[model samples]
Target: MNTNFNKMMFFYTMMMGTLMSMSANNWLMIWIGMEISTTAIMPLIPNKNFLSSESTVKYFIIQSISSSMMMLGVLLLLINSKIEYQMILTSSMMMKMGVAPFHNWILEMTEGLELMTMFLILTFMKMAPLNMISYLTFKNNLFIILSLIMGSLFGLNQTSMRKMMCYSSIFNMGFIISSIQINSIWWTYLILYSMMLAMILYLMKKMKIYYINQMTLNENKMSLKMNIWLAMMAMGGMPPMIGFMLKLMVIQLMLINKEYLISTLMIMTSMLVMFYYLRMSFISIMFSSLMMKWSMWNTEKSSTWIIMFNLIAMPYIVMLKT
Candidate 1:
């Protein structure tokens, strides 16, 4: 096949693999899906034009370890199958989803990848399915509590924006994982998190900035754009924004479920994380500068508008619904 055609094939294979993984009902099928997804993503990682080659190698090493662990756990589960096979299967899934002891590598690796890769792993893949899988098993499980505690603890002091979001994603995953105890209303939290993450990505893309220091309007005093800074504030989960509203709803949900201690811990983590968020937001928004005005570059204005609308409007919509 032609090189260009091969690249397309690889991308196609990745999508197919992801679809297969999501739809698979059996362990073997899920494993195949995972293998296909992993293989397909390998070639896409190495780029000659950017530092992505180094990132790719790091990603490969970490992901491969996790994938192998997941596969081994699944195989072990299969071998140990009994009348309670479904319970065994869920235990295996928990390992794959990076809950508890199996999750340490995930936290470490997310800090190593670039923003795009981090988004793909932690926010998109890791948080999303783990939310659902958390529901399929017992909440008080050792793995569940471990994931929650470590996720929150690690997220407390991240300075890098991408890494901070990565940890925030993990922290939020803890809350969502804890929600599995509720038996219902868990989907609401998942959906809210998904939407919040998408909006954050959108604002980041629109601003064409990555590092948290770049958005710091205070230190840069003479160099920051108002609109861009406002967008970053929204990303930090400020009031009147969808991110904030989603977080508030999650807190309320946790309280209703009588998860007072976990809720308190989560709130504390959020507040601790909020310091960086506020620092970033203040530098980006409140300290706007003429010298810092960012050019739109090749970004589509319509796309930015849509994202902005969602970030600003979703909270109001949720408030009205409640």
Candidate 2:
């Protein structure tokens, strides 16, 4: 194993911070953990060039501002614990996670990082904040609806794969927030979606792909190409995909509860997002030709464990039992 202290030390610190925040019994401890996580991740941001340095600076400014907002909200709660104050705290966490209007910093920051590092930011860094939001019983219908609308609409024209995925994450978080208001099943939904997302990013990392138009089916084996396309559809919540099932369940429950506006908006945004997903999918598929290549790029086979977990079976089985 490579013993790079810069990588190992910061990575472990990041994990430790996540655990601390998750297990903390009070908001103050959770804040400390979040700050630790924010500080730890900053050092890991790529700095081999000027753009990366810009990313690091933007990340620091955004995180510091969000952290301070979280702290202020918490302080107000301590002084006069009220639902109004709680909204401030929870909204700060949402800002930290880059839900919608607050999401630009992450887009800029992620654009400058290497793919693997960006993957970490997209998946792992948001975990603590997501859980914190879950714990807060946050149920802001307006914010959730806006996130879904803005995420879907903004992503319709994005060429950068990372930006598109970030917008998709914003859209997915709207469902997560909506679910928190409806049921406790967001945990399962989040797990299944996270795994599927990890699968897509892992493949993209191997391919060194950064743009939506760059995924040429001719460059990969038929099986791998189909799987990648399927993963993209899964992210978009196409029918039969685990993401689709999860969102369907959430929307159904919301409708039963008479949250018509949010549910209606959810459906609309989903249909719009699906358009871009199909566009990206078609671009990838149409590029296929019988071009012969005698050589392979990476001969290492994909991990069996990853393939197994990313399959729809896990969540589909849960849906079956439900």
Candidate 3:
């Protein structure tokens, strides 16, 4: 009962804070909302077992620093009488979103967060801009570009699937941020990306993948190697997948906006990132043999079937839309 109470309180605080951050008219109010959210959840992270507790500590410290830095940015921006309240709010949002050089705190914070927590944080962070961008007057295309470039290149050799996904998520965030410069379609793009991510992470968790490398180890009776490879390929935005369609659509959006140089850079970086995905796939699928111990792996048949349906349906749905 106590656990349930804590969970409910955490959920309520986060939900309220998210709504407040999105709807607040001023920076001070948003800051308060963020603080409420932060404090409410900090205990939840540390209360978990083993590494999760350690991760929770690290996450709290890093987020505290980031929050301070963001507040500093807001104060600095506010010193200018010519800047509007919305301008200050936008700058704060950018810093919080970790778009680039402004993103100094994001990677470390991400490193400390557990996979499920990170996914939720990413989803929440993405929502802030969707609600706030309309009021922002400042554009930071350079920051967005830096985030994309760094996130893609740095994510190349991540051994842990969670870390890999975290960096990849950053890259995806960069694409969405860049799209904001192009049009309001950015919100739709972000929404679709978040939806896909939520589904993918949930499915991955259901498969008991605590790390990407675990996919190579056949603790389960099933041929995880092939399934893991398929999952990675889907994430790589390979053709005949929903991720591919999202990438193709966004890149075309970039091209149409005449961001030729940035577009080219994105394409090249995407290819580089794809190489790692293929590498993981090759190692997992090609090198590993199937396991014969079927009884040990007690994965739910119904859930697996549902995940399979979604995975297959995504591509067909895209084809229909196209």
Candidate 4:
């Protein structure tokens, strides 16, 4: 499945599709681009095992339905010349982005795929739909609130690392959408979230980790263990991290705009998410009491760069802000 040519083809084709969606001037081409990206990514979903194959099918069907809904919404707009159809279009794209309430497919799909592919799906595959979403008139505020609440509450008990991240993605999507109601903050949240997630993925890849149950924190060197912990903390949007700054900015925007109820809901739901992160961190520390060999941590040169980035990324961004 990792054939060089095939992988190259998938990468190129998906990029083409994403670029098409982003650059399209008209609605039709945008939808076409969306469909193309969807189709291109289907082959990339990794059908190497029975579970992966099932996940591929599930991914295909969910995407197809979401795309169809978007098309239907577009057609309604064309026929009726009504702003109401925009809601339909936006909701469909929200579903495509795995916003909560429509979030389970992404969780199931990520659970079934391998790590690199999961990273691709989580990051790259989301851009086109998100681009489309950003252009639509922003009236889906209720969906945004629901996505945050559901992502936080449901993620509380998740045992799998990937699933928790999926919920994290959903919760963050709410912030992304909320930022849409304001201006410019969405990009900040998205970039910081992606950066934090990239750090998590890098550590997991370096350690060949896919599950909480499979890997022990004590198995890695102390420094690397701390990186993973901090990465999780950052991803969970804890204080003194870049992710927290992103949330703080969003919250400030929300309060300034007098979205007091939304602000309160967000703050409360975020605590639920933070609780699970603490729970997971505690589990990792509790289970892995044995100290790993120090040599295991610095075995690769890449470790040096990731550690530097991990330690510096948030503080540097915070410094820039100041």
| TM-scores, each model vs. reference | 0.71, 0.88, 0.78, 0.89
Q: Residue by residue across 1-322, what tens digits does model 2's lDDT show?
A: 1249877999899999989998899998898898988888888886565688899888888888889988888888778865587788777877888887688888887778876677677768877887777777656787798899989999998999889888988888888878774335776677777777787887777666779767763376544555566777778878666667777877887888899999999999999888888887777656763533333222235644444444645466466537
- Which parts of model 2 are misplaced by more than 4 Å? 1-3, 47-49, 81-83, 181-184, 216-218, 291-321
For residue 92, give model 3's deviation from the true position in Å: 3.9
RMSD of each: 5.4, 3.5, 4.4, 2.7
In terms of TM-score, the best-performing candidate is 4
Q: Per-residue lDDT of 268-313 in model 3, one digit per residue for the tens? A: 8888778887887776554445454443245456446534743775
Model 1: per-residue Cα lDDT over 189-248, one tens digit each: 656556556656655665665666666433333222444444445545677665566567
Pairs in clash, predicted candidate 1: 217-283, 218-283, 229-284
Which residue window of length 10 is worst by lDDT in model 1?
217-226
lDDT-wise, the better of 3 and 4 is: 4
Count the clashes in each prediction. 3, 0, 1, 0
2 or 3, which is superior by lDDT?
Answer: 2
Q: In terms of lDDT, which candidate is stronger, 1 or 2?
A: 2
**Predicted structure 2, TM vs. truth:** 0.88
| Pairs of residues clashing in candidate 3 | 161-212
